[model samples]
Target: MKRILFVLFCFAVTSSYSQNKISKNKKAIIASVEKHKQSLIKISDDIWALAETAFEEHQSSKILADYAESQGMTVERGVAGMPTAFVATYGSGKPVISVLGEFDALPGLSQKATPDKNPLKKGAPGHGCGHNMFGAASLGAAIAIKEQIEAGKIKGTVKFFGTPSEEKFFGKIWMVRAGLWDDVDVNISWHPSASIEADVQSSLALIDFKVEFFGQAAHASGDPWNGRSASDALELYTAGVNYYREHVKPTVRMHYHIQDGGQVVNVVPDYSRLWMRVRDTKRSGMLPVYERVMAMAEGAAILANVDYKVSLISGIYEVLPNREGGKIMQSNLELLGPIEYTDEEIAFGKGIQKATGKPEVGMDSKIKPLEPTREHPGGGSTDVGDVSWNVANINLGVTTAPKDTPWHSWAVVSCGGMSIGHKGMIYASKAMSMTMLDLFESPDLVDKVKKEYKERKGDEVYEAMIPDGPPPIDEVGN
Candidate 1:
C-alpha cells in the first residue's frame, strides 16, 4: 500500500513537471514565430506575386523547401510522384506533429492590394483563397516548433508538408497515397478566411472528372444531317447535371465548366470536353450521385449518336475533424486572444464590402466560442479532408479577408495582399505553434486524440478515391 502511494506521488510530480515544461515551450514558440514574421510575410507576398497555378508552382515550392533546408530541417522534395509536393522534418521518435502548407493560386483572379477591384494582370492567376498566406504561416509555426525542439524544451518530430495545387487539384491526395502521412500522429492545417475561428467542421467529398464527346465533323449548312455534333452530347450532359440538382439532397453541390463547344459556326467540331465537379457531405452519398451523372453522360452520348469518354481528374474525401484536437487548438487560439486591426485595415475592409454588395461590417476578428464538432454539412471541398481520415487532424481558419468577402475571387485576392491578411497570418502562426507545443508535452492528450480518431472512424476502412494513374500535373489551367 505504501509503495503504491509512493508511485502515485511520483506520477503526480512527473505530470506537474511536464505541464510546466509545456508552458515554457509555449512561450518560446510564440517568441520564435514573432521573430520570423517579417521573412514569412516576404515569402508569402513573393508567392502571391508569382501567382503560379496548380502542378506548376515551381518557384513557390522551391521557396518554402529552401527555407526549411536553411532552418536545418531535412527537406525532401518531389514526394508522392509530385514534383511540387515536398516535406520537411526535424527531430524524431513518437508523437509526430505535422503541419500542412499550400502554395497554389486560382486562375484569372489577378488583383492588386487596393480595396476596389484593381487587376494586377488581366486573366492571370492570383491568391484568391490565400494559400500564399497558408504556406507561409504554417511554415512559420513549424520553424517555431523547430526552435522548441532545438532548445530541448520539446522532443519528437516537427514536420512541414509543402502541399501544392490545393485550389484546383488536391495535391495531398497523392501525398497520402505515397504513405507520406503514415508516421504522422497528429496533423494541423489552417485556411485563410474572412473570420477567425477554430474550425470544427467537415468539408464535402468531391470528384472532378472530364467528359469528352466524340463525333463526326461536317459542314454546318451543307451536310448537317451527315455529322453527329459532339457539342450536342456535351450540352445534354450539362443540362442533365443541372436538372438533377433539384432531385439531390440540399447538401449536394454540382458544378461544371464547358471546355469546348465548336470551332466555328460553319463547321461542326469533332470533339468537345466538359469538366464536372460533384460534391456531397460524405463519400458514401457522393459515389451514387457521381455514378448517376456518369450514366447521364452515357445517355447523352447515345441520344446524340456520339461516343464519349469519362476520365477522373482528381478526388478528395471530407475532413474528419477531431474535436479533442480541435479543442486543443481552440484553447491555444483563445489564449492567443483576438487579433487587432488598424483603422486603415477596417476602412479597406469596408470598401471591399461595399463594392462587393455586402454589409460594411468591417472585419470579424473575435475569438468565437468553441463550436461543437459534429457531423455537419459544409460547402467547399479540400484535399486536407483526405489527410484527416489518415490521422487526427485540426482545422483552423483565420480572418485574412473582410466580413462576407467572397472566396476564390479578386476581392479576396486583394485583401490577402494587404495588411488585413498579413496580421491574420501571424496570428495563425502563433496559435498553431502553441498547439504543437501542447501536443509535444502531453502524451495523455495524444492518446486521447488517437483513441477518439479510432472510435470516430470506426471499422470503416479508408481508401483514396483517386485513379490508379499518377496525378495529372500537365493539366494545369485546364
Candidate 2:
C-alpha cells in the first residue's frame, strides 16, 4: 500500500511538471519559429538552387552553418572529414538534447518550382527528398531551444548536428564514429513527407559496395580469342543476382548501377565498374545475402577469365524507433492542432497529384495516430539509424508535399520549393521545439526515455559497415 501511494505521488509530480513546463513556454516556442518564417523559406530556396549532392554539398553546408552562427550558436565546421558535416551547440551541462539536420540533393532530379513538369537545369541535381526543408526546420527548433536556455528557463544543452551526404554516402556514420553523439541524452529528427505523423517505424539496414573487373583488351576481329571481356563478367554477375533473387525473402532488396560497361563494342573491353546496394528489414538478414552476392561475383570473374576487386563504399543501419519518444512527439503534435491549408494550396497539391498520376486528395493535414511497435524496419533506410543506436532518438515526418506524391522525385522537388514546403517546415519546428521543452523541464521523462532506449536496444554493440578508411568522398562526390 505504501509503495502504491509513492508511485501515484511520483506520477502526479511528473504529470504536473510536464504540463507546467511545456505549456508555459509553448507560445514563445512557436513565436520563435513564426518570427523566422520568411528567412527560413529563403534559406530552403537557396539550398534547392544549389542542388549539390552527398559529400559534395559544400555550398549548402556553409549556408546552414553560417545561419546557425548568425543565431549565436557556437559552430564547428568540417567534422568527421566531410567538409559539409558540422555540429552547432548552445547551452551547457547534462541532459544534452540534440536535433539532426540534413541538406543534400539527389542527382539528376532538377525541377523548377512549378505545378507543371519543367526541369530547371535539365538533369542537374535537385532536392527531390525535400532535404531543403528538413534542414531549415531543425535549425529553427535548435534556435528556439537556445532562446529558452539563454533566458534561464531551461538549464540543459541544445545541439544541432549538420549531417550531409544523407542521400548517398551516409555521412552520419562518420559523425557517429567520431563519438559526436555519444554524450547526447535524446535526439530529435524529422523528414518532409506526404503526411504529418509521429514516426514509430524502423527503416531498412543497407550496404553499398562497388565492384571493378579488369581484363586484357584486344581487337575484336583479329585477336578476340586472346582477350577476356570484363563486360561478360559484369553481365554474368548481375544475372546470378537476378536468378538468386527468387530464393531470397521478400523484404530483401538488391539494386545496382553499372557506372561503366565498356566504351565501345568493337574491341574487347578491358574494364567495367558497377555499384551495388543491399537492404533488409534487419541488419542480420543482410549478412548472408551479401556473402552470396560477393561469391557470385568471384564465380563470374573466374568464368570470364578476368580479375575483380570489391570495395565496400558505405553502409547504414535501419532506424530503431523509440516509442517513448514517439509518444512524446505525438502528444505535442496533438497540442499544436492540424495544419490549415488554403484553397490555393489545395489546388497546388492537386496539380502535383495530377502530374504524378496520384489521386488528387490534396495534402494530408491530419496528424496520424502513432504506429504500433514492430521489430523489423519499414522499407527505406536512413543514416539516422546509426545515431539512434548511440542515443535515444525520435524521427517525425511532416507533410511537405502532396498526398500520394512519391518521394525522391521531381514532383516532391517542385512542391518543396514553394509555400507548401514552408508551412510543413514551420510545423515541424514547433513540434520538435515543444517536445524538447518537455525533456528540458522534467528529468524524470529523460530517464524514462533512456530506460526505454536501453531496453529496446539490448546489449548489442554497434559496428559500422564500411571500410577502415575515410568516407568515399571522391567516389561519391565525383
Global lDDT scores for all candidate models: 0.90, 0.90
Model 1, 240-309: lDDT tens digits are: 9889999999888899989998889888877999989999999888999999999999999999999999
The regions of model 1 sitting more than 4 angstroms off are 1-22
Give the TM-scores of the predictions, in the order they appear. Answer: 0.94, 0.95
Colliding residue pairs in candidate 1: none
lDDT of 2 by residue, 1-478 (tens): 9999999899677656655655668878988889887888888999989988988788888988999999999999999988889999999998799999999999999999887789999989999999999898999999999999999889989999999999888999999999999889999999999889999899899988998899988998898998899999999999999999999998899999999999987888999998999899888898789888988989999999999998888888888788889988999987776688999999999999998888988989888999897776566889999999889998898999989888899988998898899899999999999999889988998988898889978988999887888877877644
Report RMSD for candidate 1. 8.0
How far residue 40's Cα lies from its native spot in candidate 1, in Å, is: 0.5
